[model samples]
Target: MKNSIAFSRRSLLALTAGVLLTGCEQNTFVPPPPRVVEVAHPVQKTFTRYLETTGNLAPINTVDLVARVQGFLQSINYKDGAFVKQGASLFTIEPQTYELQLEQARAAEAGGQATLKQAQLDFQRQATLVQKDDVAQSTLDVSTATRDNAQASRRQAELNAKIAEINYGYTNVAAPFDGIVSNHLVSVGELVGVGSPTQLATIVALDPIYVNFNVNEQDVLRIRDVMRRRGMTADDLNQVPVEVGLQTDIGYPHKGKLDYVSPSLNQSTGTLAARGVFSNPDHALLPGFYVRVRVPFDKQDALLVPDVALGSDQAGRYVLVVNNDNLVEQRKVAAGPREGDLRVIESGLSPDDRVITAGLLRAIPGQKVDPQLRKIDVSE
Candidate 1:
C-alpha cells in the first residue's frame, strides 16, 4: 500500500508539471514573419524636359466673305458649310446686270477709239495741209485740239470699261482661299451690297492649324535662359519642336513647331503669348478647341518610379521605400511629369532608395519587411 501511494503521488506531480509547462508554452508569443514586399530602385532614364501649358486651337485664317457689288442674289453656287478651293465660286449676284454694264462700257470704249482714230487722221491731214501751205495754222491747231480731246475721251472710256469689268467680276462671289465656308447669310433673290458691303458668309482655313497659348513670365525666362545657354537665336527658338493633345488623348500625339513668340509679356496677364503651327491634314483639329501643349527644351537623365507607387496625404505626395535595414519608410517626393506608367521624381528622392512597388498594403511604415528586390521593367 505504501509503494502504491508513493507511485500515485509521483505520477500526480509529473502530470501537474506537464500541465504547467503546456500552459507556459501556450502563453509565450511568436511574432509573425515580416510581410513580404517588392522593392526597386528608381529607374534612371534620359527624358526630354518640356514646358507644358494649355492652349486653344485656332484656324490659320478666318475671312469674312462679303459682296462687293450691288445686285440681287442670283444663285448659290456652293453647299452651305462646304469646303471650297481658292477662287471657287460660292455665290452669284445679278450677273446679267453687271455683264450688261461691262458690255456698255466696252461699246463706249470702242466708240471712243473710233473717234480718236478719226481725230488723229484729221490732225495728220491738217498738219500736212498746213506744211504744204494749203490750209492755215489755225485749222491744224483745231485738229490737234480735237485729237487731244478724243485721246482723253478714249482713256476715260477705257478706264470706265475696266471699272465695269471689275464690277462684273464682283457679281460672282468666290472663295479667297482653300477653306470651309459658313452657311450663306442671304437667300436667293435677296438684294445685297445695295448700300454697304454685305457679309455673305465666313471661311475658315483648317489644315495647318494654329495653336495659341500663353507662357507664364517665369517659363519665358526659363526658356530664354536655356536658349542663351545653347547659343540659340530668336529664329532658332522658332524651330523648337512642340507637341499637342486633346483632352481625351492619352498624351501629346499631335506634333508641330513653334511658329511665334511674343516680344513682350502682357502686364495684366503676366504671360507671353505664343503660337504653334501643326499640319492637320485630316482636319481633326478645329478652331477654338482647348488642348494641351508641350514644348521640349532640354533633355537629361532623371529618376522615375512607378506611378502606382506614389501616395498622397497631408504631407503632400509621398512614396513607400525600404531602407538598408529592411524597414519601411515614407518619403516625401516632388513629382514631375509622367512618363508612361512611371513618374519623374524631381526632388526628395535618392537613386539608391528602394521604393515599394508592390505589396504596399502590407508594408507599414516603421515596420520591418521582407523586401524582394526586383528590376523595374521600364518598357512595361
Candidate 2:
C-alpha cells in the first residue's frame, strides 16, 4: 500500500513539470506584425521626348588680331581682357616711317604734276609753230609724246601716294568687331609685322554663343522624321527649340534654337554635327565649356514614378510594389530620362501598381507590409 502511494506522487510531480514547460514555450512564441511602408501609385503625365546629348560652347566670332604693316609696336591702346567696341584702336605700330614714306610719295606726285603741265604747254606751242611752218612735224610729235609720258608718270605717282596712305593707316590696329580682347602678344617698341603678319591680340564675340554637338545616325533619322511629321522642313531647323545646361546646373536652364545641321553624316563616327545658338546677354556662358543639350522631338503621355522609389541590382532597376493583398513584391522597371525628381517608367509597371516609396529597408519581397497610400509629388 505504501509503494502504490509513492508511485501516485511521482506521476503527479512529472505531470506538473510537463505542464510548466508547455506554458513557457507558449509565452516565448510571438508572431511579428507587418512592416509599415509608404506607397504611391504611378501617374500618367505628358512628357516631352528629348534627344539628350553633350556639347561644347563656342563663340559666335573669334579673330586673332594681326598687324598688317611692318613697324614697331608703339603702344597697346586698350587694357588686356577688356571689352572693346567695333573699330576701337587696340594697338599702334610705329607710324613715323609710314608717314615719311607718304610725304615722299606726295612730293613725287606734286613734281610729276608740275612736269605734266609744262609738257602740255610745250606741246601746244609745238603745234602752233608747226602750223606756222616754224617747227618740224617731228618736233611736234616729240612734244606730244613727252606730254603723254608725263601724264602716265603723274598717274603712277598718284597711285603710289594712295598706297602709301593706306599703309600708314594700317599702323593703327583696330578691333574688327565689338568683342572682348585678349592680352597683347607684343609689348611696346617691339618690332611687329616683319616677314609675316604678327599677332597682336585676340578678340571674341560673346553676346550670342554657339553650342556644337553631334547626333547619331539613328537619332538624326528620328528627328528628321519627327520634323516631317510636324510639317517642318530643312528650313525650319533654326526654329526648332533647344535647351541647355552647364555641368553645374541641375536642369536645362538656358534656351536656344538649332541653327545648323550637317547635310551629310560623318562616315567614320556615324554621327551628324549640329549647332545651336543661345543668347548670352550677361556673358554668363564662356567658350569651351562642357554643357548638356536637349532637343525635344515630340510629347506624349508617360507613366512616371519618383526616383527615390527606384533601386538597382544585378537583375537591373526595380521598384518594390505592394500587391492587392498588401504583400511586397519586386517589380523590374525600365527607366527613361529623369524629368525633375521623377523618372519615366518605360515598361514593367502598371499605373495601378502601388510602389513603396519610403521605408524601403523595412520592406521585403513576399512579405506582408502595412502600405500607407501616399501621393507622389510632381512639382518641379
TM-score of each: 0.90, 0.82
> How would you encode candidate 1's per-residue C-alpha lDDT over 233-327 as one tens digit per residue?
99897789889999999789999999999899999999999999999989989999999999999888999999999999997999999998999
lDDT of each: 0.94, 0.94
Q: In candidate 1, which residue pairs clash?
A: none
Q: Per-residue lDDT tens digits of candidate 2, residues 1-380?
A: 99999999999999999999999998996779898999999979999999999999999999999999988888899999999999999998999999999999999999999999999999999999999999899999999999999999999999999999999999999999989999888899998898999998899999899999999999988888887888987887888898999999978999999999989999999999999999998998999999999999888899999998899999999999999999999999999989888999999998899999999999999999999999998885
Local lDDT at 149 for model 2: 100
Clashing residue pairs in candidate 2, if any? none
C-alpha lDDT of residue 377 in model 2? 84
RMSD to the hidden true structure, all candidates = 2.6, 4.2
Query: Candidate 2 regions off by >4 Å?
Result: 1-31, 103-155
Error of 1 at 9 (Å): 5.1
